[model samples]
Target chain A: MCTYETSHVAVEGAGKGADGWFPVTEATVYFDHPVAAMAEHTLNLDFLNRARGASARVAVELDATSAYALAQAILERLEAAPPALTGELHRR
Target chain B: MRAMDEAMRAETVKFAGHGGDEIEGYLGQPLGGGPYGAVVVIHHMPGYDRESKEHVRRLAAAGFLALCPNLHVREAPGASPDDAAAAARAAGGVPDDRLVGDVAGAIAHLTALPSASGKVGTIGYCSGGRQSFLAACSLPLDAAVDCYGAFVVEAPPPERGLRMTPLLERAGDLSCPLLGLFGADDQFPAPAETARLGAELTRLGKAHELHTYEGAGHAFFSVDRPAYRVEAAVDGWRRVLAFFGEHLG
Candidate 1:
């Protein structure tokens, strides 16, 4: 039995080829255990279901590994590119 | 001139360009301004719709003489997606080349406006962002700001000219400072592409900066869309305003 942990949900503007414009939001699902992580990909139907809102499109997938890797890479890049604007107002 | 009392004015204006074609756009100016720095705003793929107009109004409030050109004037301003698709199909799936020329025309139109100072810059979103970089390459601009545009990519072969590679190749030719804001999760122009572009700009001795927002996806600057990251959008706008002030002033 595999258990899934929902982490973060993000909504973003995406390019629409012909349907004018629409919103795409994705939820991150984490495996509760290593066995769950290695076993069958968690089907996050609930995440997808919640993503359905006004003019909403949902893309649900289990990327426990890749998503973590990308996040790490982004943090590394930010570390390398020291913040240029420094002030109480500019800090975020 | 009362800051709160100065009403924002927006009007549809047309200009006869050197090419003898009539260029149309929405001009936004502060009601009590005596002359402001000019800014030419380019729309993304959807064209100069409501969002574009609203963006112009915001720029006007920022003390800029802003103009947003309707690149798809031949096509209906608010045409349905089906109609736009049919038109694209009729054109053999080719993106219009006239868009770049239209941007140049907009610059010319702004340069000649009574309330506009000769110093001009450009700001664009998505596809407009790529066009903003293209404007810097082909035209004389004080600065250019591109929001999540695929301006730097390897061009595909002639048989399959990728949608955006030309703008990337032309990045080396940029004469003015260019600021690019991107989202981390955007698949089209991934982080790797942006890193490569920064390297190329460094090699060419050009002044450029690329800022990526964490946990944000494409089109984060668009307030009307779900991808709107309020913090990132506000930060990006501040950076853009700072860039324009530094270069255009």
Candidate 2:
């Protein structure tokens, strides 16, 4: 079934899409039917540059376990960053 | 039955859609046939892709002038189907009123074809399934088929970002005979929900048939997905063809 569940976030980053590197301003996350994945459903993430159009998107579809692991890894790596470079100093 | 040797033509077309905006579509028709019945093939939520176009061709092979409009064309005109689908999803899915208008446009396009028989029906899969029912209720059609459509009797939770409301209330407005095919194990519109819809249609004295295959889950007819169940899909198609034949043949 198409879950139709979605979460959108505004993010500041760069993603490499079909053409090249582009500034990504939004991220949409959902668990639903995949366009090409063999699984019935997957954790889909789309990093998009809305201003650049729909083609300017970097998409990933991962199994639940893999998606959870990747999420943990991202948080771990960010926490391990040096305080000066982690943006914490800038917040101060 | 249609002769296997008959030629068919499939092509991309542009027509005025919702709000009088021009949208793209894929059209398929059997060649050398006189006035064939028409069907508007609505694509699943994944956008109008290769598989959806293939379905249109198959319908043409079955002797109908079939057309599938690009529901996401307004969101991303030149983008790939997947990208366009993603874009549409982020934009909170298609509005119900707009979907009806677009389908009405598709019906007009088909009826205007040289090979049209003046009779038109609608068949849709997944999200398209719900839209098929919506269009049938909102417009006059000869027949309507809803294949594993969700959220007809129940709406998604407010947080899901799918803004559609429960369409069961519109059952009274259905203008055509309706056929619904569902999977017993599908959760979106679970067996209970399907039963509820069936009961409501019956209470309203609408002409309809609702079937749920025991061994099939959602998207049992999706050939490329793991959810595809041959037996269920086969029987479902048989019923679909027969229903359309009775109403539009």
Candidate 3:
């Protein structure tokens, strides 16, 4: 059964896709069936540049546990970084 | 009856779909010449991929002409199946009206085939399962099979951003006999949900048969996915073919 729930976000970054690297302007997060993952459902993330094309998408499927770990890792790495490095604020 | 690989003809075809829109579709027919009943195969949300095409061929091998219209063609023409599906999803999924129209077109196509019996059934998996039931309500179908479709009896949580509504209210409009295949362990249309639907259909006196296989969750019929449960899928297929035989044949 598909939940059909999706969370969208605007992201400024670059993603490497089948046609090479492209600017990613949108990211969609959902927990649903994976196209390539073995699990029945996973946390799926798609980085896309709609302007480029649908094929310009970099997708990832992560299990719940793995997704949680990745979230924590990103938060920790961002927090541990110097403010100047993250552009959170100017270093004195 | 085992059909050799070459005993079936399958290929991509273009058909006038919803609003007379030219859409790509996959058609698979058994080489056996006869007045065969036809089936409309609705692809799941994962997209119109090879597995869906296999389902079309499987039905043809079973002696029914089968067609699967690419539901994502309007969203992403010429894109990979997965990409097309993804684009459709991000755009809020296929509209119910459009789904019905495409299926109606498929029905028309099948009925026009020289060997067609003018009797057609529908079978769908996952999201398609729900659409199968929806189509039956909207069209005069001979038989319909729904395999683990969710949100047919309940609406998605309001925040899910999906463009669908529950069809239980339309149960009375069902014009065909229905066969339901569900996984006991599936949470979306949990065991309780299946029972509720069965009760409703029974109260309405609609011709429907529902089955729930234990030790199986959603997508148990998907051979390429981890959700595949061999025992459940095998028995489910047997029951499906038998159901279509009784009704569509």
Candidate 4:
């Protein structure tokens, strides 16, 4: 059963892929079939560089628990860091 | 008894697909001159990967010319299976017209085979299951099999913004005897949904056989996934082989 519940986000970052690293412009997050992970369904995130081709992608498949922890950790780290860390003025 | 067996070969080939687009496909053939049936095994949404190829080989070993077309070549040519699948999903899976074209192309390839018996059928898993049913409705096939496919009766929840709609209305157009294998515990097509599909087919007087295995959920036929149910997969294979034998053979 394909849940077909996909979440997409536009992002600006460089991600290492099969060939090397490339600038990723989009990230698609979905809880669906896992390509490599053992779980039947996992929180999958694909950082994609569409211009660089499909191979230029950084993909991750994580179980629900792991994905939740990752989200919390990301938020906490960002809260503790200075806004200048991203070389930007305000996060808002 | 020995006359029934034949050595088999498997490899990748390409043919014209929907809109004259060329795409790669895996072909498996039994090395024999005696006329034999053919099967077009549709890979699941995971993309055309090893499991689907294994299914092709299995069918070939059973004396059928089996083929599994890469449904993503147009989206990501030369890319790895996982990458291509991701790209295809992002671009909104394969369009219905394109899927039908690919299957038609596969059937053409099989019919052209010198050993082919001129009989071809289709079997698909997961999302491919729904597509298999769609192909049967849209094309003239000898047989069709659906394994734990969803969205045949209900569209992917409206929130997804997917353009797909339930295919039950196409029942009158089905061109072959249908065999539906489902997981009783699957939530997507839940037991009730499959029941609804069966009822509609019955009302339409379509030739079909529907089976739902107990204790199995979505992707129960996937050997690599933890959801695989041996009891279900084993019996399911028996049903598929027998179904194809009766119709394609």
**Tens digit of lDDT per residue, candidate 4, span B30-134?**
887748898999999999999999999989988888999999888899999999999998887788899999999999988999989998899999989999999
Clashing pairs in 1: A12-B227, A13-B227
Q: For every candidate structure, what is the RMSD over all alpha carbons to the true structure, in angstroms?
A: 16.4, 1.5, 2.3, 1.5
Instruction: For candidate 3, write residues B88-180 as lDDT tens digits.
Output: 877888999999999999999988988788899999999999999999999999999999999889887786657789999999999999999
Question: lDDT tens digits, residues B1-249, model 1?
Answer: 122554678888897532557867888876664466778898765456678888888877777778998765544334432233222222322243566677777778877767676888888887677778777887878888888776346443455323435566777678689899988987546788778878889888899988999987777876665567898999988998788767765
User: Ten consecutive residues with minimal summed lDDT in candidate 2 chain B?
Assistant: B1-10
Provide the TM-score of the second chain in candidate 2: 0.97
TM-score of chain B of each: 0.87, 0.97, 0.97, 0.97
The lDDT values for all models are 0.64, 0.90, 0.89, 0.89
Q: Write the per-residue lDDT of candidate 2 for residues B202-242, one digit (tens) a residue.
A: 99999999999999888998898888999999999899888
Query: What's each prediction's clash count?
Result: 2, 0, 0, 0
TM-score of each model, in listed order: 0.66, 0.97, 0.95, 0.97
**Candidate 1 vs candidate 4: which has greater TM-score?**
4
Q: Name the candidate that leads on DockQ.
A: 2
- Point out the higher-scoring one by TM-score: 1 or 2: 2
